[model samples]
Target chain A: MMTLDQDSIHKHSFNITNLEEIPGKKIKHHYGLVSGSVVRSRNIFADWAAGFKSIIGGELPMYTRLLNTTRNEAIQRMIAQAEFMGANAVTNIRFSTSDVAQGAAEIYVYGTAVFVE
Target chain B: MNGLVTAYLQNHELVVGSALLIVGYIVGTLFQRNHLRSIQEREAFFFKLPAVTMKLKSFVPESHWDQIESARMVVGSVVITPDYFRYFLSGIFDVLGGKVKSYESIVDRARREAILRMKESAPMADIIVNTRLQLDTMQPSIPNMPIRPLAVYAYGTAIRLKKSSFPQSSEEAIRFPDQDIIL
Candidate 1:
């Protein structure tokens, strides 16, 4: 079981933004760019539904909550990525989802890497 | 003559049976039509979220619009169709309803990716701002089935705020004269 804190892993970029290196600067700090991805399995829910089908059969409301929670988590991850970049601001953020298999769903989060000067 | 009339009546049974078959066929067709209509309604309600959310989000600020000190960007993806299909089949057992809750894994994966990216980028930044989020659909390449695979992508910038910007007044600076002011 991966805890929420465990999900908060970071990846660093070699490119550094030297906003603070300038002489007589009002603020000083090195800026970096970061990006990552989060993935979940579709089989977990499929199995659950299959079990239900074997017993009672019909659509399940449980999927709604599960999907909602996943969506929120994806957003949080994007925010976390921006936070890792050491940026005071993020822009042009976008989200997308894809079906990799019959039961699998993929959610993606991406944004520009920048240093706030 | 009476014996002949009895024979004719016995032979007419096939005709009566044929009429009953025709009537049953008509009733069955009507029931099937109604069932198809209900299925369409159910499908419409089931797949309505992505589009609705996308439209509503447009009116608000994107992830990039905010201003902050430190920020990071990440991308996460998850496949949800399998779970949906499972739920769809389970509709038979009454274990699930029209609401199939399987996309959480995808969203969770995406979030983890984004956070990891952000952490990597802004190890020391205090805060992030100007965040923007967007979503889109990803279709399958196969030509057979009309079922399109859906995908959601989210991206944003990371920022680190300078410490000096937090102070509201110069009084704090004056009180802490011993503090090494970088500005």
Candidate 2:
């Protein structure tokens, strides 16, 4: 029968001796991973709707653009964190949302970190 | 005098009635055009799904995250291109003319965002098993138009396994050539 260990990556180890010295070795590697999320206040997103109603009229285009930009920024931040850890890969990635207030929304990013070797 | 007065009044009424009718027609046509435009835009936005999916996948691992063994749930989201709003309006025009095909940029943006988020949350694990894709629309408030954002997430139970239980092909293990002792 298949055991839990059979399904785990822990069972494997990579040999990095042949490869050039990676920068991460000098710095203390974080035992766990890091993550980033971009969140917006509901009121903030609502401004787009109000803007559409009064100015452009029908379908707020500005807000969509804003959110897109924010999300990208958040993602970039997360990647930077992983790179700093000297990790080539990450696992168990997940996202979550929370209502910060009546007019606010929060986006959350979470993941796991591992050392390849 | 009575007959002449009646005729004058009839003529005035006819002119006013005709004018109102013409105005009504113009207003009706304008409203119809606006409605049509909105519908076209909606269609364009929805049609962009495939490209968005493809673009988002590029940033995320095409295969499952290999580090996790089991998972209960997974969820993620990414904002489309910054110009996603422009496209929403342009898509409306495109739907009518059949010319709305620039979804690659948006898709790429989404993929990158999702992967970045994934990286942030799950940096140390070797693999993230059993990933799923989720799409959503973000509208901050009733006053704001909803922006379509997509996310790719891979979730599984994170575990530590000894070298014997893991798969270590030369190609996959080459990244860590220094840790040859365990092998």
Candidate 3:
């Protein structure tokens, strides 16, 4: 049991899956809910540019790029935390975003960690 | 029409408001129309890309397939904001408390565009599973500021099934992706 516990803590490549099951793999264990979250804010320069963009606007690509990177970071962190528990894959993954402050926002990624064979 | 224009022009403040309204309406409507047209074109072009629900789970069950093959996550992102014209329309609409058509369509177009782009990333996948759309509303720090941009992101895991018995389609379906390039 000691050796098995240490082995589980060592880690493996983390996979993010939305489906409950990996197509052809057998699930060895279910590790319950795992999540990662991050809060981000833009600098003054970008905010100034975004302010100008709001006029005569169609798409604000800067904010899009910013939030995209933020969300990706959150997902990566979630997978990393799950992997420390010996989870090979995260299933039924979902994302949520909320206001942290005036300009700052937080993105949360959550899923069930499971060891799949 | 000419007399009404002259009447509005006679009042200095009214003339400025009228001019702004006229410019906003023309430019705003033009942008909205063009965007909708492009969205419609792409929707039809990517019609062959199959998108399913989380309820479907994986395309192939474990008993049906020997190997999992490839399962990759795909994303489609769109950031859309209201034009100056929509801002003007919204200001008036808010006081009257009616639906703001401009914003409604802007969000609609963004959502549809995001989904289509995600589907594009894995065109050959057997099925798109557990598709999730994340919409983030962005605003400037100042209170009651006009700038509000909505970021719509659609994502899903595209799984490739190795089954050889899947039916074949016409050559047209094969060639559609070439013409449907989002860039």
Candidate 4:
């Protein structure tokens, strides 16, 4: 078991999967659910670019990049929470995104933290 | 004089509207065609990688379970905005309250692209299982705008099968030093 403090750096590379079980491993302990979320506002410049792009119609790469970054950060935070609980793996991970306001969106990720071997 | 001014304004509006329609049609068609072609090419490239919406055990045999190396979550996301032309067509369809073929194509392309991106993320994985897709629409509260960005997110667990022989004992099994419990 890890005894590291909350502010300490994570020493282990935690595994994350969206499946019920982690392949090639056995779950030794379960620590219940851990989740993380973030709400981000759209950048003004990107919004303007998106407006122009919509006129021509196609993929909005700027918004895509922004959302991807937001989601990855949310997942990282979830992993951090799992690490804080001394868990080395998280299973059955799920993600969701919702628009909270006019230009802001929130991304939430959650999973079951577990110790595996 | 007032009548002449009104007539000129009407003609100007007509010219601008027609010009925008023409531009939107040509550019949107070209963009969609090119995107479709690229999507087809990438799909062919990733034809060997199997991504299923079922559990790995349900499909793979138990005999090969020992050969599994690792599994990790993979995700692919895309945000697409419909071109002016498609949006216009969909608006007309909405008035008719029927099938919006134009919007359907947008969702189809976004879903496929998201899946393709997910596969591209784990090129070396043996297979991806329990795949799921989430779709959302972002309509920024910009006043008087018909723009709605459709976001498609696809995620799954990519499992890699080992190539070497399986370990015979606990001592012989591969161990992750960082994951081991310290007494």
> For each candidate, how many residue pairs have backbone atoms clashing (under 3 Å)?
127, 47, 0, 1
The sequence of per-residue lDDT tens digits that candidate 3 reaches over residues B28-107 is 67777887898888778667666666644345655665654556566667777776677877888989998998778878
TM-scores of the models, in the given order? 0.30, 0.33, 0.77, 0.85
Candidates' DockQ values? Answer: 0.10, 0.07, 0.24, 0.36
* Leading candidate by TM-score: 4
lDDT of 1 by residue, A1-117 (tens): 111221232334212221212111122333343333455554455445533322222222343334445655765566566666666443344455556765455656454545434
**What RMSD does each model have against the real structure?**
17.3, 16.8, 8.2, 8.4
Model-by-model lDDT, in order?
0.37, 0.39, 0.70, 0.79
Over the stretch B1-183, how does candidate 2's per-residue lDDT look in tens digits? 999868867898776645544553454335435644644554353231211222212323325334323222112233332233334545577668754443443344444444333322332333333344454444345534343333333223222223223354533245333332122
Docking class of 3: acceptable
State candidate 4's DockQ: 0.36
Chain A TM-score of each model, in the order shown?
0.49, 0.50, 0.84, 0.88
Give Cα distance to truth, residue B107, candidate 1, Å.
Answer: 21
TM-score of predicted structure 2: 0.33
Which regions of candidate 3 deviate over 4 angstroms? A1-13, B1-24, B57-62, B65-68, B142-144, B163-183
Q: What is the lDDT of residue B95 in candidate 1?
A: 60
